[model samples]
Target: YILRGWIEDRSADEARGLDRAGWATALTDPAVGTALEAVHDEPGRAWTVEELGARGGLSRSAFARRFTALVGMPPLTYLTWWRMTSAGRLLLSGDAPLSAVAQQVGYVSEFAFAKAFKREYGIAPGRYRRVENARAAS
Candidate 1:
């Protein structure tokens, strides 16, 4: 959430200087990309939809429709993808405990994170990390 918020805040600062003419060039601008990157950092930050929509000065409904048109996936789907992606990074990074990694990525339960992680990677997180590290080391 801190990363996402930083992205949102950074975008707000950048957008403050952009004009209507600039917005006309894009239905979803660069800030949307930044927000999307933040989402990639933590897809389970359930507030991303509301947060991203608010960043664009848009209502949730409008944001949903526009986001779908531009990003080709609804905001929630993107969020899920982002969360799973981040979880993959944590699993591969091998620097954090599974429970700690889960909490950092917004999963409150180690079991819950494991379930989701397996769903995404087709293996348990610990084994997945070990395999990846061994492969890289080789």
Candidate 2:
């Protein structure tokens, strides 16, 4: 229930932002919102368009089109971005091993996780963590 409140709060914030663009009512759209919630609630899951579309009660192609139009990326692309960001937060804030962090963010291999992390953040996860730790200490 606490997580659901946070999600609702974020949607309200997004709606406020959208008000400036004349689309505030889009916050009421269940399809895109449901798909987003599924992704955010389970970033560690192996998410696919078909699965997400099913969650939204949308056809695969329709969900892809609508999600991209509303969320600014295809479902899978957003999933990767979300996973990377979630992993980056873990790297910054915790002492968890890189392998464990990878698993938490749905990567099975540390090497793949490192590669993706570097691709997204422009630095390896270990180095990024060290830098963040240093910053926190200072």
Candidate 3:
């Protein structure tokens, strides 16, 4: 009941364009929706474009085209974006170690995770977490 209400509220927020993630639009297509749900459900999984295409009952090329058309980005692009986004949230909200956060987001290597995170966010994860923590404390 509570979860249902929260989902409804989020749906309403998305409908009003208040959701910044912009994922709701992709849910309108059944095939794309299936793939999107899988990604959201398991962002930490090492997902391949071919595997995601199979989940949607599509061929790789067709799925990539359709996913890009609907999501405004390729599948792996969204995956990386999602992984980084999740990492950012973990950084802000928890005291988890960087390596733990990295693993949680599917990066096996802390160095690689930091590199990717810096590329996406323009700041190191440790620094980002400190900055966010300070901001919240203020």
Candidate 4:
């Protein structure tokens, strides 16, 4: 719904040559795109730079350099960003427990996930879920 609308809007902007940066631009490269797609499609996978580089058919150093150059961030950084983004969406859209959300985003431990989520979002995951749900209700 909202996510689809946002994607369509971004696609429309790109179609009009708005020159936006980030994943849309980074995905134009074949090698980087392959690696990025893998990360996006299976964000819960325990990924390593070596594995991602292999998916891109490049040496680890080469893939890292190209991904960083095009994406404006390191690959793992983007992975974390995507994971947190996914978790946030799940939190907003459902009544899943925090542990489930944590596992879905690749965190095996609720404590660790909460710490990472808090670091990224500046609020703990449970509180974030509650606040966002309350705001949506209002």
User: Which candidate has the top score in lDDT?
Assistant: 3
Can you write out model 3's per-residue Cα lDDT over 6-103, one digit (the tens) per residue?
Answer: 36446544554443344456676777888887887788899999999998899999999988878768899878977887788889888999999999
Specify the poorest-scoring 10-residue window by lDDT in model 3. Answer: 1-10
Rank the candidate models, highest TM-score first.
4, 3, 2, 1
Q: Model 4: per-residue lDDT, tens digit, 24-74?
A: 667778888888778777878999988999987899999999888887678
The number of clashing residue pairs in model 3 is 0
What 10-residue stretch in candidate 4 is worst by lDDT? 1-10
Instruction: Go through the candidates in order and give the clash count of each.
Output: 1, 0, 0, 0
Q: TM-scores for all candidates?
A: 0.67, 0.80, 0.83, 0.85
- Tens digit of per-residue lDDT, candidate 1, span 56-96: 77778877777666655687865654566567666776678
Off by over 4 Å in 3: 1-23
Best by TM-score: 4
Clashing pairs in 3: none
lDDT of 2 by residue, 77-135 (tens): 76887788788778877899999999998999999999999997789999999998898
lDDT of each: 0.66, 0.76, 0.82, 0.81
Q: Native-vs-model 3 lDDT?
A: 0.82
